[model samples]
Target: MSKILVTGGLGFIGSHTVVELQKEGFEVVIIDNLSNSSINVLDGITAITGKKPIFEKLDLREKSAVQEFFKTHNDVKGVIHFAASKAVGESVENPLLYYENNINTLVYVLQELNKLKEANFIFSSSCTVYGQADELPITENAPVKPAESPYGNTKQIGEEIIKDTCKVSAQLNAIALRYFNPVGSHESALIGELPIGVPQNLVPFITQTAIGLREQLSVFGDDYPTEDGTCIRDYIHVVDLAKAHVVALQRLLAHKNETNFEVFNLGTGTGSSVLEVIKSFERVSGETLNYKIAPRRAGDVIAAYAHTEKANKVLGWKSDLTLDDAMASAWKWEKHIREQ
Candidate 1:
């Protein structure tokens, strides 16, 4: 069995990917600093998979530590990098931190991989890179606009770095999956999103509000030119997004004479407005949610979704879960965390 290393394995997306990788019969090792997540997520993962991954508490920002980690785990076949400071609002306030953490860690990891004879690398990119795309159902060929915020810029820069690195390095092959609004939890609800402070994403905030952890939701602008006059997004189930990473990794390992770098969009290909999401949550949980229309957030896009034909055609993967299913699964996980 080939062993794989997942950075930020304790995070929301990383944990789900770990479960999916384990189910595919891969030996998994995780590296996390526990800065924005908890070790308890390991228990949640084990509860569902009945197998715990090998984990190391190491921060990738430290150059020496990252070098030593790769040295110690020299046999790692592929790397799935999910570690980064990913808050848009916070990134604006602290741009340097985002640049350092997001850029430095990726460079360090790639540096380590450059030594290997052959290695596959998967990076977590975001739809924010396509700021207010001129067209609907954005594709991988969509032109990347100037990033709206520092956080989004980091993702753009990260992708560029990987592309440049792959240009000269024969040992590394990379795929950057540009994701659009990943939400929901695993079906078992044993492992789900665990936001540290106030939740930045829509589904988590909605779930927290339903559980009374938060008093209400903020619908950031209703003046946008759309059916509901609010921002729209393609919310993909976390599990489906997780499965894409595995497929991307497999593709990199199989293909030869392929460009060392490639990108694919991961989304449901359907747009959902903020109002629609709240309504869906209310229907799923049978709970009234308090919300107010606030001013437009500075960095938010009015609407964005994906044209997933590339992923579907190339990787033979498509999202299987629906919005209602995502909401229900998230609500179940919220309840489980509250009781525990």
Candidate 2:
């Protein structure tokens, strides 16, 4: 079995991907700083997979530590890079931190991969790179708009960095999975999104409000052109998104005649408005959410989903979970977290 390195493996998506990788018969090694995640995620992952991955408490920003990690673990077959500062509002407030954490860590990881003879590099890119696209379902070829925040700019820059690295390094084959809104949790509620501080995403806020951890959810805007006047997004289950990483890694390892730097949009190809999501949560969890309409948030796109055809045709993957299933899973995870 090939060993795969998962940076930020204890995080919401990273942990879920670890479980999928293990289930697919891949040996897993995890490196997480635990700055934004809990060590207990290891326990949760073990509870689900019946096997705990090899974990290291190392920060990727420190070039030496990352190099040492690669040096010590020379058998690593591929890397799923998920370690980054990912908050749009916080990125706008602190651009330097975002640049430092997001860019530097990627550089260090690529530096290590360049030394290997054969290695696959998977990146966690975002739909924010599209900014506010003119089309409804964004495709891989969609024109990338001027990034609305520093965090988004990092993804654009990160993709550029990977492309440039792949141009010179034959050992490196990279895939940038441009993700849309990723919500929900693992089916067992063992590991899920544990956003630090106030949640920036909508699903977390809705879950928190339903759990009574917060006063009420704030619907950023109710005046959009969409139905019920709220912004629309294609929310993919976190587990489904995690499986995409596994598929992409397999694609790269199989040498499927793809470009050295390829991009795929991972989404369900269906848009759901904020009000629609709230209703879905209510229907799934039987909880009425208290929310109010607020002014349009700056940098928010009215609607953004993915074309997803490239991912389906190339990687042989598609989303199987529905919005209600995602909400139910998320509600289960939120209740479990509250109990803990």
Work out the TM-score per prediction: 0.98, 0.99
| Candidate 1 runs further than 4 Å off | none
Q: Cα lDDT for residue 58, model 1? A: 95
Question: Candidate 2: minimum summed lDDT over ten consecutive residues — where?
Answer: 251-260
Off by over 4 Å in 2: none
lDDT per residue, candidate 2, 198-226, as tens digits?
Answer: 99999999999999999988899888888
* Residue 41, model 1: Cα distance from true site in angstroms: 0.3
List, residue by residue over 1-340, the lDDT tens digit for candidate 1.
8899999999999999999999999999999999999999999888889899999999899999999998899999999999999999899999999999999999999999999999899999999999999999999999999998889999999999999999899888998999999999999988899998899888999999989999988999999999989999999999999999998888877773257888899999999999999998889889899999999988778899999998899777899999998999999999999998
lDDT of 1: 0.93
Residue 55 lDDT in candidate 2: 97
What overall lDDT goes with each candidate model?
Answer: 0.93, 0.94
Best by TM-score: 2
